[model samples]
Target: MLTQIQASFAVNALTVSMAGITTDLDTPATSVGTAITAGTFAMAAFILLGAKVGSRFGTRGVFQIAVAIHGLAMLGVALSVSPAMLFIAQASSGAVIALIAPALTVFIATNYHGAQQARAIGFLAAAIPAAGVLALILAGWFATTIGWRWSFVLMVALAGVNLVLSFLVKKVPAQPGLSIDWTGAIIAAVAVILLSFGFSGLATWGIWLATPQAPFDVLGISPAPLLVILGLVVGQVFFSWLRRRGREGKPRIFDLRVLATGSERAVTACMATMLFVGTAANFLIPLYIQVVQGRSSIETSFSIIPYTLSIFLASTFVAYLYGRFTPRLLATTGFIVVAAALTLLAFTVRGEWSQGFVVAGLILLGLGQGSIVALVFNTLLSAAPKQLAGDVGAWRGLVHNLSGSVGIAVASAFAVGMLSSMLLAGAQEHPEISDELIAQVNFNEANFLTNEQLAAVLESRASGPELDAAIAVNAEARLRALQISLLGLGAISLLAIVPATRMPGRREGDLPEKLEPDDDDVIDPVDEKETVA
Candidate 1:
């Protein structure tokens, strides 16, 4: 269980760090948008497929296969030349996750029970965030020194290690004669692909009903909004198909019956919200350090050390709090703390603010997000039926992965949109500014400017004293653009509060009530039953 947990964390860390590096390499907002979409699409497809495969082959088999696939995919990403190749590699890696995640959950259920299972899952959950910190630090250093390719190479090596560890596990006997839902799989895949592409396009292109012409002509026509609509329609059809198949005694992609449980819904919601908050913070902070503060990649990664440490510390102790404190209280408090940190960050992002503010904010955010995530996963697994553990685990993974991807996507879109709007507003206010000047001013490097500096630059551009004023104005504008983007991200953090409220209050020692036998069952002499019943 520990090995699997560590492997899962390592895999996620590699993927996320690679994503951040890819954004840096492909500097434009459009590139970031596209990469996020491609990566997300690939992840969704892989997880769904992997779940089906696990059902047929058993957890260990699926896990080993995933490890191999992940290694190859990492290598492919490292060697990729074109954007298309990168997308393909990302999708393949995502597929690997699908295989491994369900298996990991099944393994936990099979090997451990009760509080031990909860603790193991908590530890496993913590591994991801912990690994993320490590990945970011490593990626920043490697990207700065050896280049992003080396990071991928490192990922391949980690995947190899995971493969070896996976082989050490004893295999569970496979469930015989399980059938795969091919049609449902195809529909789900298509829906995810279309939806990811559509959302990516929205982030790159304008989100208005009618597309604006200023951006590079995409497919010679705007396809974002259209694709989103198509995806929704396709998703509806997929769900209908699943329903029909269930009625026909054929296998279905999603077992909707499992979702009927309140605990299941709450757990899924909590995980989604946790991912949303955590990923949004992760997405923005690096940009804040590297671009706005003009920190080197290594420096930026180092800056996150406080956050990483806080997460590690917080995660380690959450298991102790379970049973003593309800998940609702812990999660709610976490969300509030995170929100407070974000709000503080928004206020402190001026020229006069110290680096300490940023570090403090990062630490708080990490502590809150890390605790909530660990707690939520532990609770969800405990709440689920033993027989349905694999399915529930897959569902949890699906929601978390999807939420993280969408959170980043939405955050990127919102930040970019706000930055663009602010830039345009500044430009309009200074009508004399040239397009070249505006282009220079529109650079979206994070951490490059303070709000006051940006305002001053806009003022100078409006006054038009000299060429130097123009340069200053451009620089300031670029800085302000980055600042506003951070603010947008901070605002998004508040959304987590709503879902956090829905979490149950159960703590670690509080055992859930076991299900009673159905009334039709004949009592065995060895079993004790209440005489009144």
Candidate 2:
């Protein structure tokens, strides 16, 4: 619970702090998004490696060390004065989290029985949004009062608490002789980095032809799509390599048995899709409130309270419905609600920080996303064998981070792309804004800014009338971009309903399957060791 809340604290603090950080670091919003992406991508890259390392050492030992290191990393975040430093700090925290994630499941599976385990899993899932509520209020206050830096400072204190509490967790035995799968780790890292960077570059690197912002191009074409294709191919290669290692009786990075069934795979896909949508919406909402509307952090928090509270309530209480509904029915209904909520948001949001209809949409969104988030884990954990609980946790962590990273990156790129095109077209059509002013601004960079930020960028290049015209164009463009993006996301969510139908099924009124922990899976709370193959 502590580790999961720590992870959520990092995300929530940084999330509400994006606008302030962008201003402080003198960088674009995408840079802030990249700092977030760096952390999430690191979570994906180091998860398997962390699992192997936990096995080599011991779960309890790794958990303690990771907690301590994360505290240090949170300190780094507090002191960071530049985008690069922020990225490094966040990435370090994320990598350390990978080591702690597997232990969460191990402790639960090793210590708890059937109903206790289900309740434990619900608490685990609920921790995220619960932390979000706390972080938002606290971070919002910090950002509006002292500074955004103090938000991370609080995390440093929390980390100490977690480190002390971690010792209470029961220890699990280790497989000291299980060699690390370095080959698979390398492949996985490459795939994730390629995908994350490629998605981020789509806004800067031209969608079709090469843009000056691109590092390099493939022939005359943009490298973004090429990199995305390469990432997909490399991902497939990683899976193929896993198959080969299994055939050869070599130590594989992941045990394929965790996802061997079609139901498991479908659950994973649904999880990814829901996370992708949820994270994207999370990113866009703050971006609009803080950057576009020029609201303070406290106001941002107030506006978002409805959403966060709804998620917390839904996640905590969704388990009770498990007895009355099948996982498939629950999941399909959840996705449908998600789609409706997003569509409502797309149509209702316009030129304001808060409105009755907008709050309604946010409430609906939280209920849908929170329930789905809790349900997928509940279903996966209940159905999978007890011995594989740690692996299931690692798998859930991987998908959560990867999908979330891509969601933010893609949303940033998409919104930026829309800003560029609409800004240009709006400029050309406006009577006051001249061609000279348009030529002066570097639209290729795709840095969407508020009226004040735009004026600073233009400096003396634009007269009052010209600047007003530009700002008018910019304001409308940003709004439309956000609206269109939300609609597209809604469409994607509706598509997920098809796959949700394929998730683990249960008879009406049937509780989720829960098995007793294997005798070998647990060890002495005092001291016990295992070196099994």
Candidate 3:
């Protein structure tokens, strides 16, 4: 559970410290965004390898070593004075989390069984939001007060504690003879890294045409879209490799049986969709509060706490509803709720800070997103045998990291892109703002700046009514950008209903007081020879 918290904290705390990083390092927000994506990309790329390595070597030993390394990484983060150091330390922490995440899940399989396992998974889901809540409050405070570095100093101490406490977990049996599939590992890592990096870079490097910020261009086209295409192709190759290995009775980096059935595949899709929506929405809220409104860190915490608390509550208590509702039904309703919440937010969001309607929309989002998160994992884990626990965890981690990276990337790109278009359009149409003044301002490099930031930019170049109009346009543009992004994400959530319907449904009277142990749950995955669909 602490491992899950650490994973989530890596994202949330960095977000809270963005302002400090920009100020202290004399770097732009885009640079900070890149650092955050580097961590996420590392996690996505290395998670499957973590699972295989843990199975080849004992999970207990790997977990401890990873935790210790994570502590050192956090220590490095605390001392980082440049963007490169911050990036390296954060990426290292994310890479080690790839090891810890699967190890934690495998430990649950080793230590718990049946209903207890379901509850444990529920708690694991809950921990994600719990970390968000903690990050918002603590990271915000630390960033506001002493320094952002102190927050990492605190993480280093917690890592040390986690390392010591890891001794309590039961030893997971290791398979020394099971050779690590290096080919599959390389293919999978490349695919995930390309996808994660490509998605994240779309904001900076143009979505289609090459932007000024792109490192290189392919015949006037951006590398971002090309990378996404290549990632998809390589992903298909990884599946083909898996099929070959499964046919030859060779060990795979990931077990196909974990997602062998159509229902299981649907479960994975639903999980990713739920996480993407939640992560994107969660990211956008703080971004608007911090960047657009120029709010304080504690203010960000106060504004976001209710939403995070709602998610935490729903995730922890949602297991009680499992007996009454089917996973399919729960997932369908959850998507609906998420969509409705986003619609509410879109219609009600304004240029100002949090309003009553905005708070209501956030709470609705939290409840829906939280329920689906716990339900999907419980459904997926319950279907897989105990031996495949590590694979399930690795896949879950991959989705969690990839979806999070993509979600934030899409949100940033869409919001900033809309802001850029609207700002120029508003300037072109407005009677007060002159085209000459607009020419002086480079809309191409537009950021989610506050009125003060816009004012500072326009103050020296031009003054009076034209400057006011430009600032007003910026204010309206940034807010409308957020609204449009929310609307689009809401539409995607509604479309996710197609996948939700494909998830496994329970029979009319299949209600059990607890998710009790079944024969399939205890079966050894190696003995089962189900073909991958």
Candidate 3 matches the true fold with a TM-score of 0.89
TM agreement with the true structure for every prediction: 0.77, 0.84, 0.89
Overlapping backbone residue pairs in candidate 1 total: 14
RMSD of 1: 6.7
lDDT by residue (1-533, candidate 2, tens digit) is 76788888887788878878888999898887777777877887788778777877888888889989998999998998888898899989988888888888778777776556656777888889888888878887788789999988888898899888877778788778878899998998898778866776676786668888788987879898888889889989998998787766677777665675567777888999999999999989887887778887677777888898898788878888887888999999999999999999999987675588888999999999999998888787766655566678888988887787678778887888778788899899998999888887777675667778887877778868888888899888888888888998999999999889888676212222333223223222211111122
Candidate structures ordered by lDDT, highest first: 3, 2, 1
lDDT of 2 at 160: 94
Candidate 1 lDDT over residue span 83-107, tens digit each: 6776677767666677777788777
| Pairs clashing within candidate 3 | none
The best candidate by TM-score is 3
Give the range where candidate 2 is weakest over 10 consecutive residues by summed lDDT: 523-532
Computed on alpha carbons, the lDDT of every model, listed in order, comes to 0.64, 0.81, 0.83
RMSD per model, one decimal: 6.7, 5.9, 4.1
Across 383-447, the per-residue lDDT of candidate 3 in tens digits comes to 77667778888999899878887888788888888988999999999999987888877887788
User: After aligning candidate 1 to the native by TM-score, how far in Å is the CA of 83 from where it should be?
Assistant: 7.1
Could you tell me the TM-score of candidate 1?
Answer: 0.77
